[model samples]
Every structure is written in structure tokens, then in C-alpha cells.
Target: MSYLEFLGQYGDRILSGTLVTVLLTVLSSVLAIAIALVTGLMRLSPNAVLRGIATVYIEIFRGTSLLVQLYWIFYVLPLFGVTLEKFTAGFVAVGMNLGAYGAELVRGAILSVPRGQWEAALALNMTPARRMIRVILPQAVLIMLPGWGNLLIELLKGTALVALIAVADLMFQVKQINGTTFLSAETFGTALIIYYVIARFMITPFMRWLERAMQRKLGRA
Candidate 1:
């Protein structure tokens, strides 16, 4: 079939899949961000026990392959009685796995904040919680924004793997249509274009805007 004909037949399904992809990306990004924050902060904790736990968490997730993690979440977890829906499993695995990596980014960003900032906060007798909320995290955010933005795009691309576990994301939809119609190049090519559009026009620009806004907010501009 011609590409237009293929699209006419499957465009809506693909669009729906694209929307699912975006939704999953957004949801996972939120989860990843939250995880990054918590674990990242834990990395700075003075308590050796807490710091060790956070360090192990980050290392375990980061040390393993994401595909293995996804499969374990989807396939093995059910065996352990922790059942998750396909979408939920995909989101959790992707968010958590990426969050482990993001934790390093957060930890580094927090550490990169001038040592004077911490000393100044302590000198002012700011409470630990207040210091994190008011003094440290804000400054770290500007540095973290760029790294997290890149991770967001990685999350977007990573959603494709969800299809392996039966999530009806863009890649899954494309596979289904391609299997039935034998329109390999057309379906996949369109999927590629759609992802490109999202990454280029939507995700990239949004990340850039976010980074710039953060820099301005932090007065680094």
C-alpha cells in the first residue's frame, strides 16, 4: 500500500499510540524527578545508614540493564505477588531506572553548589530542612535542569521498550499494524517521524525553555 493509504488506515491508531507514548513519558518523568530528589538528597545525608541505603539503591538500579529491570518488573514481580498493569509496570521500571541515573545528576549538582553556600546557611543557623528547601535545592536545580532535561528525552525514547510487555504504546501499535499490513517502512517511518517531531519541536524546546527559565530564576542569567 502507498504510505498515504497506510496512514489513512492506521493513522488514528498511531496517533493514539503517540499520545500514550507522551503520557507515559510525562508520568515517568514526574516519578523519576521525585525519585531523583529523594534519593539525591539522601546521598547527602550525614547518617551513614541512610546514605548507604541510598547509595545501594542508586547503584543497583544503575548497575543493571533497564530491559532486565523492565522484564523483572513485568514478568518476575507477578510471580512474587506484586502484580502491576502493563502501563504501571512500564512506568515504574522506566522511572525508577532512570531515576537512579538522575540521582547521580542530582547528587553531583548538589555537591557542585559552592561550599560557601552550605557554610553560609550554617552560619545563619538555618535548620537542615530549611537549608535544603530554601538554600541548597534551589541552587542545585539550575545545574540539575540541563541533565534532567536530557534524561526526559531519554525517557521519551525509552517508552518504546514498553511495547515488549504489551503496553499499547507507539511502537506496539506500529508493530501490530505492520504485522497485519506488511507496511514495514511506512508504519515505522511514520513512527520515527512522529517521535522526531515530538523530540525536536515539543520536548527539546520545552527543555530549553525550562533550563533558561531556571537559569533566569536563579539569577545566573
Candidate 2:
């Protein structure tokens, strides 16, 4: 079939799959961001216990393979009666894996803030929380925006892995269509274009806009 004919025949299904891909990427990004912030803060905590716990989490997640983590969450966890749906397992695994990486970004960004900022907060008798919220994070987040933007694209690409566990994402649907039609070039090529459009047109623009907004807020624009 011609490419247009193929799209006409399977467009609805592909659209559905793209929507799922977008949803999964968005939810996973949110989860990953939250995890990064928490663990990243914990890594810098004065309390040794918090630091230790954060270190262990970062090490275990970063040390392991993401595919293995997915399988363990979907398969092994059920053995212990902590069952998760396929979609949940997919996003959670992706989020956790990326979050481990993002945590380091956060830690580094926070550290990149001038040491004088911390002392200024201390001089003002600011609590640790207030200092982070008021002074440190505002600066650190600027450094973080560029890294997080890169991570967002990585997360988008990583969503393809969810197809292995049978989430009906774009790649999963492409595989299904290709299996039936045997149009390897058309099917796979279309999928590639779709992913690129998302990352290039949608995700990239949004991240740039977000960075600009944050910069404006900080009077750095």
C-alpha cells in the first residue's frame, strides 16, 4: 500500500497510540521531576541518615538496568503481591530510572550556586527550608532547566521501551501494524518521523519557552 493509504487505514490507531505515548511521557516526566527534587535535596541534607538513604536509592536505581527494573516491577513485584498495571509499571520504571539521573543534576545545580548565597541566608537567620525555597533553589533551578530539558527528550525516547511490556504506545502500535502489513519501511519510518516531530517541534519548543519564562522570572533574560 502507498504511505498515504497506510496512514488512512491505520491513522486512528496510530493517533491513539501517539496519545498514549504523550500521556506516558508527561506523567513519567512529572514523577521523575518530583523524585529528582526530593532525592536531590536529600543528597544535600545535613542529616547523615537522609544523605545515606538518598545515596542508596540513587545508587540502586542508577546501577541497575531500566529494562530489568521494568520487568521486576511488572513481574517480580507480583510475586510479592504488589501488582501494578502494565502502564503503571512502564511509567514508574521510566520515571525512577530517569529520576536517579536527574537527582545528580539537581545536586550539582544546587552546589553550583555560589557558597555566598548560603551564608547570606544564614546571616538572615533563615531556616534551611526557607533558604532553599527563597535563595538557593531559585538560582539552582536556572542551572537545572537546561539539564532537565535534555532529560525530557531522553524520557520521550525512553517511552518506546514501554512497548516491550505491551503498553499500547506509538512503538507498540507500529510493531503491530508492521506485523500485519509487513511494510517495514513505511511503518517504521512513519514512527520515526512521529517521534522526531514530537521531540523537535513539541517538546523542544516547550522546554525553550519554559527556560525563557524562568529566566525572565529571575531577571536573567
Candidate 3:
């Protein structure tokens, strides 16, 4: 059968899976950003207790594999009477695992701010919250934007793993099509192209825009 015919035949099923992938990416990314912001700031905190907690959380999540975490959440949790839906387990694991990695980016971005800025904020009697929210945070955003973009792209690709957990993501649909038609190359190739379009056309340009906006805000544009 022609590739076009194959595509037309199973397009709906594939589109459904793509929708799931898109939803997972959006949900996990927002959560990851929040987690990155908190843990990132906590990592730079002066309080040893807070820093230690943030450090431990990052280490635990980053050190472990995402697939293992997903399995633990979906399968093992049930052993303890804490069953979760497959989609929930998938997003939670992806968000948490990526959040740990993102926290490091946040830490580096914050620290990249010039020391003079922090000192000036202090001299001006700016509260700690004010310093971060008003001063350091803006500057840090320029640095963070690139790293955040990279993480978001990773999240987009990472959605493929959700299929393994029965979340019906793009990869799951591709596999289903392949099974029914025995056309592995066509199904997987189409999915790969779709992912590339999302990452290259959508995600990359958005990140560039964000970076430019942050730089303009800093008067560095």
C-alpha cells in the first residue's frame, strides 16, 4: 500500500495519540517550570536545611532513571494501595525527573547574575524576595531562557516514553498502526517527522522569542 493511503487509513488513531502527547508535554512542562523555580532558588538559599532539602530532592530525582520512576509510580505504588492512572503516573514521573535537571539550570542562571547586582539590591534595602523577583530574576531569565528551552524540547521528545506506560502517546499510536498494518517504517517515520516539526518549528522559535524578550527587558538587546 502507498504511504499516503496508509496515513489516511489510520490518521485518526495517530492524531489521538498525538493529542495525548501534546497534552502530556504541556502539563508536565508547566509543572516542571514551577518545580525548577522553587528548587532552583532553594539550592541557592543560605539556610543549610533548605539547601540540603533541595539538593537531596534533585539528586534523588536526577540520579534515578525516568522509566524506573514511572514504573514505581504506576506499578509499585499499587502494591502500597496508591494506584494512579497511567497518564497521571507518566506526567508525574516526567515532570519530577525533568524538574530536577531544570533546577540545576535555574541555579546556574541565578548565579550568573553579577555579584554587584545582588549587592546593590541589598544596599538598596531590597528584601530577599524583592531582589529575586525584581532584580536577579530578570537577569537570570536571559540565561534561564535557553536552558529552559532545551528542557522543553527534551520534554517534547520524552513524551514518547509515556506510551510504555499505556498512556496512548504518539509512540503508542505508531506501534498500534505498525501492528495492524505491519508497516513499521511508515508509521514510525511519520511519527518522527511530526516530532521534528514540533521541536524545530514550534519549540525552537518560541524559545528564541523568549530569550530575545528577556534580553530586551534587561536593556541588553
Model 3 clashing residue pairs (backbone): none
Which residue runs does candidate 1 get wrong by more than 4 Å?
none
- Minimum summed lDDT over a 10-residue window in model 3 is located at 210-219
Better of 1 and 3 by TM-score: 1
- TM-scores for candidates 1 onward, in order: 0.96, 0.98, 0.96
List the lowest-lDDT window of 10 residues for candidate 2. 1-10
Superposition TM-score, candidate 1 onto the true structure: 0.96
* Collision pairs in model 2: none
lDDT for each residue of candidate 2 in 1-221, tens digit (9 for 90 to 100):
78899999999989999999999999999999999999999999999999999999999999998889998999999999999999999999999999999999999999999999999999999998999999999999999998998899999998899999999999999999999999999888989999999999999899899899989999999
Q: How accurate is candidate 3 locally (lDDT)?
A: 0.90
What Cα-based lDDT does every candidate model obtain? 0.91, 0.94, 0.90
Q: CA lDDT of 84 in candidate 1? A: 98
Q: Arrange candidates, best TM-score first.
A: 2, 1, 3
Give lDDT tens digits, candidate 1, residues 150-195: 8888888888999999899999999999899887889898899998
Error of 1 at 122 (Å): 1.4
